[model samples]
Target: MVSPHVQDELRIFFTSLALGACMRETLAEWRPVVDEAIADLVPREIDTEYLESFFGEPTYAYDPDGLQRALSDPLWDLLDRGGKRWRAVLFLVFVEGFGEDPMAYLPYACIPEILHNGTIIVDDVEDGATKRRGEPALHHIYGRDVALNAGNALYFLPLKILTEDPGNLPAEQRLAAYEMLMDELNRTHLGQGMDICWHNEREVRITPAEYLEMCACKTGCLGRIVARLAAIITDQPERVERAAATYAELTAVAFQIGDDILDVENSLGRAGEFGKEFGNDVREGKKTLLVIHAIEESPPETATRLQEILEAETNTDDELAEALSIIEDAGSIEYAREHALELAADARAAVDELALDAETTDRLYTFTEFVVDRDV
Candidate 1:
């Protein structure tokens, strides 16, 4: 949950931007169906029927209980914590943008969504995060070994489409899907590697462009996967596919920036915010756009103090609160918010330029708005 004071500030901030009032369609039309598909894809209980259907009849003896313990339990525990599931919704929106029924291509939504939850699990481990979605992080509850295996397993689970022919694509289409998924996955890993290097070694001072490029590689990945996969499923031409993917990537980048803002917001109310404890990013010495901007723009002593706080072995509430005050004084929070708003607007404009079906384009627009607006 967002901190009360910060949530009030953000509600005022977002409201001033004239963002949409609500996103009921996401819950009414999207959430139930997307979650149901996820349940069917990633099981709570492993039965012979599920295993054989997904993996075909095993040559060796299979243990249902083993899968439930090792894979399904921790996975569901994390997923059950709750996610916006926007990646799946984005895939469906892309399908409709090409004048196809999103429901017709619904099951494929699991591809990006599961990959996303996988990344969250891995991220929490890497960040040594304590909580996710208001619960102790998976690694903290389950052993690191269990969480890691479960998280890593999520990466490969969606590939079942290739062998199982769940979507019943022609051979060529299946090969294309595999290629796109691998390409984006590789890029995301590279982004994560860059992030790790920056935070782990505080001497590194990265430029704004470098940070954005990292986001383009990491969080930006799933949107491309969702949109391009939608393009594939809908049989759209290459031009359409490229356009859809570009628009979705833009939205994802904006969403990433907004999340960094939430970390600061989390600091205001408590300790960690989004991924772990409120102000956890501050504790981790994360180099978010807010940190970067404040460092560049603040008075020398203020900036130096901020950097020192971030690079500290550990921080106190006083230090964390001071760092936030420095950022706010430098206007970095509003600066981050402005950039996020611009990106969201750019994403929406890209959709408007597409000149797709009116309703389809509207859904895309609303989704993009929802991304930046939701947290506020």
Candidate 2:
């Protein structure tokens, strides 16, 4: 993971290209704000006084150091690992797009970023992944119990900010935000469940539409939360909220498809350039859009062979390499890339339905471009 000092550079620097030079530079500038928000909410160092302030002075004594070790360490370890923190930035972008001064809502911006990292810690364990951000998964370093508890803590820790109205938002707005978070969280788990079930299949049982739907749930839920939270603060009409949420959701789907492309294209290097192992998706037999499309478009024999590698009890490095070749030969990489572009267009169309200002619309367009075009 790059250090916070380097991250002061650009958040999505390694991602695919989009936006003009001016906006691109501005996007980098947006990174540190999200970073600052995350730091503010979940500091690297924790003490009893901090706990008392957050959880109230305990009726019993507070084990500050132990809680810090168990909770703060693992969460920070994962955070110190590289994440674009785009979700938090996305929250701010939408707030600005809806014509709100995003700084006023900065505290709320931390929610999705923290929750996204929480998912990563838990996801690594669920995926049985060995590496994250070029190192061992948190579970490996912290022990399963500690990692699990730490990961779970991230999920609820941000909720306290919401429930306590730390932002001093109205009671009605707080309730709306709370309900939205709960709804999206459920969708995220269901999407993860579908992902697990599909990957575990012995055959290609998932369609492109089905895969897109799963992505809408798994990856898009947090994206939706980012937009929806902004909508709440902006007090946008339902139509505007729906349009903004759709843009976020579809952009997330496009981003996931792009990442799946990298699973085959860039999987050969970078130890999961996108925070996973080399060919990690193949190793997991992840039925990514690449594999799904290859199976459908290739010759029957070729299709059968690809499935054989995926369904194998365990794949060798050679076999995974072969799988990449098979998908490439089927031209599934370009096919998937084209599909991602379509999703980005769909996302833009969602924004077009809104009457937002040109700058806001352009920024949304720029974000969609980044999602489909990113290299990792």
Candidate 3:
């Protein structure tokens, strides 16, 4: 049984998760307006079948039940597994900071959630991850081919959502949003490429600077996109936008480092509770900041053993234990914690520079605190 305090935390996280569903419902309300606009713009009959084919072929033809079960059901189930909705909240918070009605940007808020879940579906396949949000990964249930198609399908939905202007955003703003979204997608994929390359190259030593850059591209880009879009919507000055992006980037770095720390610590079964296998990063040969620090600081024998553990085709429980011990003995865990704190502090300072209301600023600061202090 979970403690009352832990239950309370889960409740809060679920509440945030519900916000994404709420945004989806709100966007559904605008479908009629969007359909009418599309009807006016296009004269031909739109081929509905192509929608499913956009990502790839269906599992079976002339069997609606089979197709739905193979793709749509699994995709929706994965999304339903629930998340902290941090990205959506970040976008909404910035929208509020600009004095805009957040509800008016509900469709925009859904973009990040869609993109995030899509990435998770594909990432689980890439990492051979078994669980997500306390449920089996989409690929595990639906097969990798179907999961990949569904996940990639989700990637295009955001483009459709953004370009369709369900909220009746100005044409210029819509174009700008599309441009920003494209840039973010590019950065994310590039960063993922770097990560995949490093992991595959087991013998390659990664520097702290390289790891930070990867985090900026892979993790920080989402926050940067949200801030930039919010600024665009609010017609804020360039300087304010830059500050917002900087704050979000810093927050992302801190959050990712904290995540790496948790992967090593597996604190209180937090990783399992959060729907991930603990220490799988080690199994995957991830060159995390702690690993880098430990290798650079530990004794030659310890560092060599750590590398061998990472490079091994498979690691037993005892081997993983030894790797964790090396990290702790080298003080890399503490180093990561302190580094996350410093990043969070810099994020707060960046928020201070933004021309936002006091309440908005406080919310940003609170989120920064949550990034560094959250246990799960």
Candidate 4:
């Protein structure tokens, strides 16, 4: 466990990163907007291009198959229209702190985020998720087939970027980075597959452990790999990789758990509206930690009612209300929140073990806390 003073020191350190002279200079000309806050802090034109292109006006090659148009059209609008790019920025920040030029790793830095964005585009369709970033989903805007192709294109963007000689990184290092990236990609897809299959089949009962496992794959793995890659960029591959991976694993679980809790409470802003009907997870028989815990802790009658609600062909407002009531009565939300807090604690400890520069260590630790505690 990390000592309280150490944890507090780490927090102070990260807080300082926001206001430090170095960061101030870095942040000086850059303004923080919803779309480009992360990009603002970066020093390079290409970094900005990479960031903005994803968020702003992005056009790709033309093809009658619509592959180019579909894949290229909504990406910048979709990515730039929303999201903090916190994960990508975190990678760059840490890379800078390690005395490496962040520009050297720009290609690698944005890959995970691009992959994440790609998944979101596809997932909105798969999950029938409607709203994104406070707007209609790409599928809703462009139609499903185009939206799917657009996501596929975003998914491939990283590959092209990775193979480029942007940083002149050694072939061995590039290969290692690619391997790590592929691993994360595999996990993310696997987790998504399970999530979608569970939604469709409704036969596999979920336990908290299973939910965590899924979260680790779908969310945690990529986050961890990003951190690990940062370490690799900094040339302290082993220690940083282990530390970042540990932090990523814990934070990812906390992130997904928090998302689940938000889903239940309807507190997730645009993403909340995108929800598959209200209480659609239950209606679709998706197994989430909240539902699993609620089932375990609620009264038998409440459990039966919950199952009936889930097993029903569709969920009415009354059924949704009843399910929410049962979940509240069982204190599942509180339990889930506590679990997230615990994971945050684990993340702090994990980073503390690394022999990172004071600033990097502090920022990484603080970032984890922010993720665990973020309202949105």
User: What are the RMSDs of all candidates, in order?
Assistant: 7.4, 5.0, 8.5, 8.2
Worst 10 residues of 4 by lDDT: 26-35
Number of clashing residue pairs, candidate 2: 4
For all candidates in order, the CA lDDT equals 0.79, 0.81, 0.74, 0.69
Which residue pairs clash in candidate 3? none
How would you encode candidate 1's per-residue C-alpha lDDT over 93-134 as one tens digit per residue? Answer: 677668775555667878898999889998999888888998
Give per-residue CA lDDT, model 2, range 101-151, as digits (tens).
666677788899889889998998887778999999999998989998888
Q: Highest lDDT: which candidate?
A: 2
Supply every candidate's count of residue pairs whose N, Cα or C atoms clash at under 3 angstroms.
Answer: 7, 4, 0, 2
TM-score per model over all chains: 0.87, 0.88, 0.79, 0.78
Q: In model 1, what is the error at residue 213, expressed in angstroms?
A: 1.3
Error of 2 at 309 (Å): 1.2
lDDT score, candidate 1, position 139: 93
| Model 2 CA deviation exceeding 4 Å by range | 1-19, 22-30, 267-279, 316-318
Clashing pairs in 4: 55-80, 71-150
What would the per-residue lDDT of candidate 4 be over residues 188-305, giving only the tens digit for each residue? Answer: 8888877777666644477788788889888888787778778765667576678778888898899888877877777212233544456655556667788889889888887888
User: What is the Å distance of residue 40 in model 4 from its true position?
Assistant: 15
Ranking by lDDT: 2, 1, 3, 4
Model 1 TM-score?
Answer: 0.87
